[model samples]
Target: MATATTTAVFPLLLLFAAAVAVPSSPYLSPTTLFQNYQKMLTNFKIFIYTPAKPFTFQNPAASLFYSSLLNSPFLTQEPTEAHLFLIPFSPETSTRSLARLVRDLRINHPYWNRSLGADHFFVSPTGIDYSADRNALELKKNSVQISVFPVISGKFIPHKDITLPPVNLAARFISAVPENASTSSFLGYLKWDGKTESNFVEELRKDGDFLIDIERELLDPVENVKNSKFCLLFYAGDVAWMVEAMALGCVPVVIVDRPIQDLPLTDVLRWSDLGLLVAARGGAKRLKEVLNDVSEEKYNVMREMASAASKHLVWNEEPQPLDAFHMVIYQLWLRRHTIRYARRESF
Candidate 1:
């Protein structure tokens, strides 16, 4: 008999047992024939739980998550029949609701404590400005957090946790702008308030005036985004325009230091293969040269890629193949094996 010295031993044993010896889940058993028949239809299901209000429009990101989940094909009311448990809550305080929900679940349900929340997940889109009180964000302690902008530092596992694309279709209706530029104009905030690097636009623009500067007040931001051949996208803040540009068949030139590893379908679809990626601070310095360097033919090819990827950006009520709705579910499906539960234990 050998002593198991590695952390991988337990997982490996569980995997082997699942392949050879695990029985049909007792938790899925029904009370009556009618209930049993209903359970038969529940396959590849997601159980939704919100200890607080499900529809909290004050939190735009959270409201979208609830809407998207409700419309998805995998959603179900039956707990035992679910493959994934979704804990949707109004994270106004960020932790109180989560703490109470977990406590309630632990008392009434055995699923959470079985895996210590690895099987459970929640989506809170507004993780920004959470630095004021880091102790309040309950996600750091347990569970996989699905957020638009996850706090990547601390114990937040970027690879394990889901980083959703920010959807801003509500700004669909036209609004006033300064004036649309003759050339393709950059549209969005350049000032780094708190989250990103300090203002560096003046330094980047010194090389050449290839990129047009259109004050957001002059023209419709949508028109500016659509009309542009190349949209100047920085990692600073307000990246909604990237998806907006893609939806309107405009190519995006992403200027950032690190690779965008947290994007949806990263395992299958490569970001660089679809859009332009310029290096860090130096890339910003030589921004004009980088844009000019792209051949007209390559630009067209990139636009085609953008058009193809745009379909996945838009979420529909009816989940379509590779669309935003299915894409999120697909990521969950890939992680299904990681969910550790003690036989849905005798609760």
Candidate 2:
């Protein structure tokens, strides 16, 4: 009886051993196992590089803008970590030179290229203060992932490599100005001090019978423009001045020949949008037509739309710049990851 019991127990033990010996799945390769492990360990880290200490409104603005990436709802509940590196550089650095420096840093530093992925880089164009020569276009061309929160002058143009959408000031304009105001007319400040010149002013005065200049009781020069139908913005100014004009609820007649590349026109204005567009280099003849074509009804409708648009431009609120930065970073990250995965597959 003891021998028979031992035989039954031995068979049972053998069956258990057999089960343990069976592999998880013959189809599972070593490469697959390694990939799974790699995926588990890899967490892409974003590196933000600034030229100065993050103190001023510009730096905070940049921080707030980039912070949106971590706040994204689509990502998992697990927290992600990113690094910010502030390099103290002279405010006098030219944009062209900065672009070259960034390119050189990325190329020479093996850690930047090999240890960290391309998506890790976030190069800020402006430092603590605004720089005139900082070319965002050049940086976009050289860097793997470049994000610019430029306090753009009217002169900044988008290069082919830069994927940023036009920075729309329409919302800002609408928010700063009173939407309830019935008048669509604006007075443009085109003070001919030999520094700035506009052909539209001369043409409109001659062709459309529009008032060119008026003497007012106020001491300030801009005060006279308050009652005018529209102010012609032939050139771009410092961000503060532009914001002031928008705050005054004055409709800007943008007359720059190049496209309003910085304004997010598509987001704020449709193709049928009613704002007057005068060609900068095309002469005042087209501007006169645009001025004449606008009827009071059309003007009022545009003013209403423009007002509604302004409500969206709350400066303290989550700005469009934040959203724009997140978009470019995510896109580059995805592309980089896809390439990495493809390389692994080929092996």
Candidate 3:
């Protein structure tokens, strides 16, 4: 019995030794893994052309959108590289001229059609006049994805088939202060010139609630907001700024004219869902009630939820605008690859 046990243990030991000795494939090796990761990252080269200087939220949205794609398990880091190209918005370079330039590049560049193709995405928030007006819809039909966020209407002809993705508000990071807190009740800080029309301020004042407005102060609004239980967003400026306010632990009272219609992201984000949102017309009374009823326990719970949601705002996280952009690019790449493979096999 002792001899048999020894024999069994010997074989097991040998097997273990053999397993340890065998080298993993280069793809599995640590050095190889790092190299492949770097290689994968080089795949998608993003080229952004923005004439509106100083890298504003609109331009940064494109970068943030692509960065979000890194969260996907299917995304090989090499296949999603990005680059930015800036064009000047000048009187000499009219919007029509820029549009012509974009069209010319798509038609003239050979690789532009193959690798860059219509699937290669472009975002211009300023207007076609600032960049190139090459019809994004036409590019999308061909296989490139182009998104334009025009500051004004009637600048670019609307594409009948292509619908712009909804603008997402980072709702998860918002926190509401309980009524029992000794701090100020003000909800948000804004650069109010005393001339800018704010529906929130007007409504609150009408409801006999006083609002503290500190216009154009370089002072940190977060410090003021931290002491307050609530902050107010009168109009939609940049979704990022809204998210920033939420990060500081204040609940937002978003004031919108059409509560549901004007916003592009009404489907995924509801005012009630974030425990935020006040309609321009009938929200003042509702806002007061919500503020008054919030208890310490409930406020803490909402704060946690908002913090969890804020994680999605990070560039390399799922369910963001970048993931949508990656899906479009990958689909186009697979289609083209399949066609080429089929032709090769036939030949």
Candidate 4:
């Protein structure tokens, strides 16, 4: 296990540094800012709009969302006294459906027309949050969007919009993989939507000495990652699989087409130390070289880092401080304080 390139010491040092350094930043990150408003979060006022169809509770994201908000310490049933208005809907919930809901609410409520939805927010539980729809466009410009998959560029104003964490594994959902799980396998979880090119997968297979497969079966993603040491992720910046990989003790090998502007829990976790990154230009050809450089000892250390970080990724019925649920709220809280949207002329 005495490898020259990698060791567990690096992660331990990085983790220690993050613990000390985050508190001393000149400007506070969302998680830091959340401390000032922690007390208010429980009483944080929110008025949830009634949709034409009830919000789905069957999906994990939907179910956990209901529990987080309704059980939120900041629950407020009254619209007038609320700090923000929440309209919760699933990924399949269309722009037209939402617009109609808002239109109906605006007709009945003073809030929507009051400021053209500046203080209001809605949840889009999809991988792509930006919309081409007219009403969705207006809200993008005027109101805050609490989204799991956020486009942080011209699509959505990062300061105004909330980038939510994906639904985390509940305590009940955690698979009991041992802490010292073997990682001899590398599983690339790819969507064959023309994104996972054939050439790329072929090149990886040729790179050899590793059991690399894009095999799909009737198994949970977490279970696959748990058995593997490395989980290959592509076009994953907009998704929460990275967090899931880390929590499951798999060092994620994230291949990106461009520079990563931001990531979940940036303030809390030092991701560079915990995983591998490959540029998309000839990225597959470079995968073996990248993982080879990381010694087994170093890989083990990274696994430890992921295990520690996993706790923060969990969702409990009663939300815990800095857990996934609180992280979503913290981002929302941070955005509310970070940006002050002007009234949209008149509602």
For candidate 2, the per-residue lDDT at 226 reads 47
List residue ranges in candidate 4 displaced over 4 A: 1-34, 40-43, 57-59, 89-97, 103-108, 112-115, 127-135, 149-157, 163-195, 216-229, 236-244, 260-273, 292-304, 316-321, 338-347
Q: How big is the positional error of residue 235 in model 3, measured in Å on the Cα after superposition?
A: 2.4
Worst 10 residues of 4 by lDDT: 1-10
In order of TM-score, best first, we have: 4, 1, 2, 3
Poorly placed runs, candidate 2 (over 4 Å): 1-47, 50-91, 94-138, 142-194, 198-200, 203-226, 236-249, 264-274, 281-285, 311-347
lDDT of 4 by residue, 228-275 (tens): 677676654324555666666777677776666344545445667776
Write down the lDDT of every candidate, Cα atoms only: 0.53, 0.39, 0.40, 0.57
Q: Is 3 or 4 the stronger prediction by TM-score?
A: 4
- For every model shown, the clashing-pair count is 8, 16, 29, 4
Could you tell me the lDDT of residue 170 within candidate 1? 35
Name the top lDDT candidate.
4
Q: Which stretch of 10 consecutive residues in model 3 shows the poorest summed lDDT? A: 338-347
Question: Pick by TM-score: which candidate is best?
Answer: 4
